[model samples]
Target: MNSFLAIIGRELRIGFADLHRVVTPISFFAVVLVLMPLGLGPSPQLLAKVAPGLVWVVALLAILISADRLFGDDMKEGSLPQLMTLSLALPWVVLAKMLAWWLMAMVPLAVIAPILGMMLGLSTEAAVITFLTLLIGGLGLCLVGGISAALTLSTGAGGALVALIALPLYVPILIFGSAAVEAASLGLAVKPYVLILLAFDFLAVPLAPVAAAAALRIAIDD
Candidate 1:
């Protein structure tokens, strides 16, 4: 427990050290959200119809933008291998890093999603649903992104490679998240979509770090 807290604190300090750069992904998320209504010609009905999908796509991309850095610094400083050697479980360490990443990268997007949804003509109910979905879906994004980030820790392509590796895995989460918001907007049952997302989150939250820890070990060994 102490190790987990320490890991998370260390990650948070590192993440916030470059606070301006750390917020770049959030800025991109905001730009995408703001641009969509302009690009789509300002039709309220049309914007509302597409708002859920647009938000999910932008949020996923924002996460991808930050994911590549999750392990890059540690690997570069040779601290990743040292972390791997710790008495604490490597998976927990990975999870701690991911949690810090999520807070830095996704929390801002989650916070702004409702405002963006409203701008896109989504109703109050839809906006709320969008916020919830974005928060949960963001976790899944970081989880899957952690694996890709670890896999590409030694690769030259960096962020592009992380996107390519993680994007396919993001599809199901995007579908379910968008569906949940769409359903809420239409006065349909949304619990099913949210449930699917929760089920995946529950599975991914624990399992992804384990897989990522293994991948990081391999990357370090190579």
Candidate 2:
């Protein structure tokens, strides 16, 4: 228990120490949202219709872009091997790292998502739904992405491999998240989609760390 909290604190400190790691994803997220309207032309109706999907897609990409770095620094610095040898289980350590990554990467995106959604022409209700869905779905993204990051840690493939491995898994979250926002936009019940996103997180939270830990073991062994 002490070790787990220590790992989380250490990861958070490391993440904030390198502000680029924390800022890059959010910057990418904002830049893409800003440029998308220009590329698609300034049609409010069109933007409103596509805003849910666009926001979810861009957010997923931003997470993927940062996923490779999740384990990269630890692995390079020899901290990962040290972590694996700790008294606490590797899965717990992995979960701690994932929690830190979620705080650093996903939380910022979630906080700003509603603002960006409005800029994309989403109604106030839909923008609120976008924020809600992001908070739920982004944790699932971080967990699943952590698995890919662990699996590909020794590959030297970076974000390309992380995206390839994680994108197919990301489909469900993307679908449900976009659906929730869209339903909100149309004044429809978003409960079902929100529930589905919650289900994904429940499954991912416990399972993803174990899978990622196993991958980390394999990564270290090879």
Candidate 3:
């Protein structure tokens, strides 16, 4: 457990050192959320109508862009192989790395969401709900992104390939998460939406590390 913590800390330190990649997508997460109002004009009805889809689209795109950095750096430096051989448990290592990756890429977007949400004319309640939904949904996004990252690491087209593969899977998250917010605005119950988000995340979280580790093994073997 201590080793896993240290490894997570070490990876986070490395991620900070590699801020150029991490920060840009986080920035885009904010930029894209704010783009719709500017592009389509800022009317409350329209913003409410499109906000969910727009948020989902931005979240998906941000995840896609950020996937390239997941295993690419470790694979380049041969650290992935070393991690694979360690007794600390490869799944834990993969989880730590994915969490670090999420912190670098997704957490920032959550923090900055309210500021961006205002541009879409979301009410205080709706903005908070949107942030919460994205928080949960983004975990699944990162987990799935980790898998895609591992799968495509060798191809060097990791970003594009990840987007192609992930987009279909991302649809449910986009639909449910955004639907949650849109539902909230109408005074409807959002528990169902939250539960669905959790179901998706629960499904992805466990499988992601295994899949990523498998991809890493393949990467090392090849």
Clash pairs, model 3 backbone: none
Q: What residue runs in model 1 are displaced by over 4 Å at the alpha carbon? A: none
For model 1, how does the per-residue alpha-carbon lDDT over 1-222 read when each residue is reduced to its tens digit? 999989888887876787865788889988888988778897898998998899888889888887878888888888887887889989999999998888888878898999988988999999999889888888899899999999988774788889888989999999999999999999999999988999988999989999999988888888
Taking the tens digit of each residue's C-alpha lDDT, what string does model 3 give over 94-170? 99888877777777887777567757777777778888988898898888888888888777777679888778878
Which candidate do you rate higher for TM-score, 1 or 3? 1
Q: Whole-model lDDT for model 2 versus the true structure?
A: 0.94
TM-score of each: 0.96, 0.98, 0.94
Cα lDDT of model 2 by residue, 54-91, tens digit: 99999999999889989998888999899877789999
Local distance difference test scores for all models: 0.88, 0.94, 0.82
Q: Candidate 3 clash total?
A: 0
Model 2 residue 8 CA deviation in Å: 1.4
Q: After superposition, how far is residue 152 of candidate 3 from its true place, in Å?
A: 0.9
lDDT of 1: 0.88
Candidate 3 wrong stretches, greater than 4 Å: none
lDDT of 3: 0.82
